[model samples]
Target: MTETVAVVGGTGTLGAPVVRHLLDRGASVFVLSRNATNVPAGAEHRRVDLASGEGLGAALAGATVVVDTANSNKGAEDVLVAGTRRLLEAGAAAGVGHHLAISIIGIDQVPMKYYRAKLAQEAAIESGPIPFSILRASQFHQLLDMALSAAARFGVRPTGAAKVQPIDPDVVAARLADAALAGPAGRLSEIAGPKVQTLSELSRTWAAARGKRRLPLPVPSWGKMGKAVAAGALCNPAATTAGKDFEEWLRHE
Candidate 1:
């Protein structure tokens, strides 16, 4: 019998691909999300909310690994931290072996509210008794696109108070799946794109893609600690980071 993998937050962007990759690798997958109806055809879906501690224990049963991609904008504590606690506790009771979490780079230095939440989430997964790997990633190209799209609507494509090393989500999913197959490496290596570009350049890229020229205002306090790319908060693009660049991702998409 093949191993079974559970993808927490499987409904999210990255989580969906992780599920598909696991299935392609001959592993049976359980997709845990609030909406069970939309889970892919081959996978079994369960309705569970990690925030309320609802149905988590039952959903986690009989799994070999749990790939956690769950997050909420509310804060790190309420969703990432608390949901992880519920899942880890349940995974332990259910005899789950490995735990994998998707995280972000520059979480420590940026002091961004969301990144702080990410850091806290990482800490929770690490301190849990389960063997785990926290894969920290750069801003995904899709994330960049969304950010740019939101900015373009306002006709203000702001230039850099910060930089982003954007990676494709396909590469991110593949790396996460590979780690799952290898079991736990405690805390594994971080993931980043090949190039480093500022958000201004990102806006230009998006604007050009749309057949228009645009510029964004450099807004302060875009997010917590968002003003300090000189601090290299999002500038570390180690070759070991893993993943393709935004241009490449756009080509493939």
Candidate 2:
């Protein structure tokens, strides 16, 4: 039987590639989001609000698998944790067989607020009725690029001794698409970039990529979150690494 996959937040960076890959695999795809605009071609769009649980039922209907790439930084608790609960409830009601979600690596060890909410979201899915698969990925190259760009506007690139193994979102999207088709395997191996480099090094590489010549200002990793990052909590050495390194991605961009 052909798989019917519903990609929540399918208009976003990682989600868009997931929708495309699923379509390439011959699965019927639906992009569920609050805004119907910018929906990927070859896939249907369904407007659904995760915070309010509005339109979830209709969006999830006839879906054999639901890949949740939806995330909110501003309203983490309301949108990620609570919203995941809502998605699970709706998925269960719709007879969805598999629930796959993308999560950050070391969310358990990291004391960041967003990471805490994501950990809770994972808990909600684990305790829910549906079978699920969770893929924890390292930070994306785009995330670091955006952060560095914002910092550059202030005329200083502040980077601590923290190490980061940034993965490409397209690689993550491909893994998610494969997992959606493979059925729920539960807590798949984490994925990361091939190279683990310090934030300082990455900052320099990014600056060079953009045709700028600025040395990264060394900042101290003071707090618990910073300590965790400095201790390499976010870099999983044993993870299945398959993606473009930060430099490679920068070249393509």
Best by TM-score: 2
Task: Name the candidate that leads on lDDT.
Answer: 2
In order, candidate lDDTs are 0.80, 0.91
List clash counts for every candidate, in order.
Answer: 3, 0
Residue ranges of candidate 2 with Cα displaced over 4 Å? none
Off by over 4 Å in 1: 220-224, 240-244
Query: Model 2 scores what on Cα lDDT?
Result: 0.91
Question: Each model's TM-score?
Answer: 0.91, 0.97
What lDDT tens digits, residue by residue, belong to model 1 across residues 43-122? Answer: 99977888888988888888899999876887567778888888899899999999999988777877667777787788
- RMSD values, in order shown: 2.2, 1.1
lDDT of 2 by residue, 33-151 (tens): 98887676789999999999999999998999999999789988988999999999999999999999999899899898899999999999899999999999999998999999988
